[model samples]
Target: MMQEWRRRRQAKRVKPGDGSPLPRFRWWQLLSRSLFTLELVGPDGRPSSYAVDVRQAGDKDDGEVRARLYVDGALRMVSRVPARFPVPGGEIEVVVGGFGMKRCHLVAADGSERQLVPHPRSAEGRRARFDRDHPVASRGVGALSLLAVLVGLCLALPALAETISEIPPVAQAVGTFKSPLNLPGWLLVTVGVAAVVGSIERALRLRSSWIDDLAS
Candidate 1:
């Protein structure tokens, strides 16, 4: 019984078309808000024709779709459809079967077909290469973020402590020195200068590092 079922399924899978097959290409999806063409290649190892189907997801319109066949990047024959079709960008997908010679071409409404070419050296590939080459900056940013989290935890540690008994003497002394705005002017000025100088130094160091990086 199982053999009979398997034989029946295999028999049903046969297509009754001509045995001579053309190269097949189909639009699997359209994700970006961009228009594309669907080109079909003939059996003779060249781009033969294109369907004038606009690949908008939910557009409503009708027009003729035409594209010229090309050989060695030269125009050969023009094929046309009778009705105008609106392809909605971002929501619709147009499917074309059998598009493979050297490339696939999608015919636009303006009677022009755009060929799809494969690029091995794409932007994503370049980005991966860059990450592989100069990983220090990325790693440094991650390390700095982790260090910031650690510093935040260290600052919070005193708050988490059970009692003032565990607090440091310097913190206790600063708390006890209650002043009615009686802090020394010279001491305040000195502290302010130190803060400014420290901040400027850090900024200058970072700027120098960035400039050196760019120059490298």
Candidate 2:
């Protein structure tokens, strides 16, 4: 299938990493950097720590974004984003979303998976802490973000339809279509911006859906 072909193609893009120590996550780089860690049992029955680090600013090579895998603080492998690195028990999967990390998890041989823990100073870490500290408030904020995205989508779909209907080919085929809701430019811009922010908020919690997150 096409999905399997794409996966194989992406796997070919992976390259070995330089053996350098992984840098500590800094508070100032919270927005641009992401670090997630997992502990796995080694063959010797000892625990080994692995870390996945991604820098959105990317490297000097044409701003090519990559994910770096570190084992016990030393660089083990590196590849472009949406990487899969072989590990002791299984593999570490790393994927970047529009706003932040979409997936960062350890997958076991038996098909079990576990999300890596975010660095304490990272935005994701802060969001996790907030959820634990203020469960009710966190739920309210999450609901608001979903509502914002929903409203934005409702507004966007009509405009999109109207625009598509105006295209010559489409107009000739089905005639021009009118949008039911028309709003001022400023309000449309505001809703778009709110939707973007809401999507980012959801990204902080590693939440993403093609329709809800990408559509808006």
lDDT of each: 0.32, 0.85
* Local accuracy of candidate 2 as per-residue lDDT tens digits, 1-216: 997787787688678878899998887998998889888889999998899999978877779889999889999888998898888888788888777888898888898999999888988888889999999999999998888888888987887898999999999999998998968899988888888888888888888555455446
RMSD of each: 22.6, 1.8
Candidate 1 ranges beyond 4 A from true positions: 1-133, 162-216
lDDT of candidate model 2 versus the reference: 0.85
What's the alpha carbon RMSD for model 1? 22.6
The TM-score leader among the candidates is 2
User: After TM-score superposition, what is the CA distance of residue 20 in candidate 2 from its true location, in Å?
Assistant: 0.8
Each candidate's clash count? 15, 0
Give me the candidate number with maximum lDDT.
Answer: 2
TM-score of each: 0.17, 0.91
lDDT of 1 by residue, 37-144 (tens): 334444565653333222223232444333223333333333232111222211111222111111133344465644433211422223234446778864564344
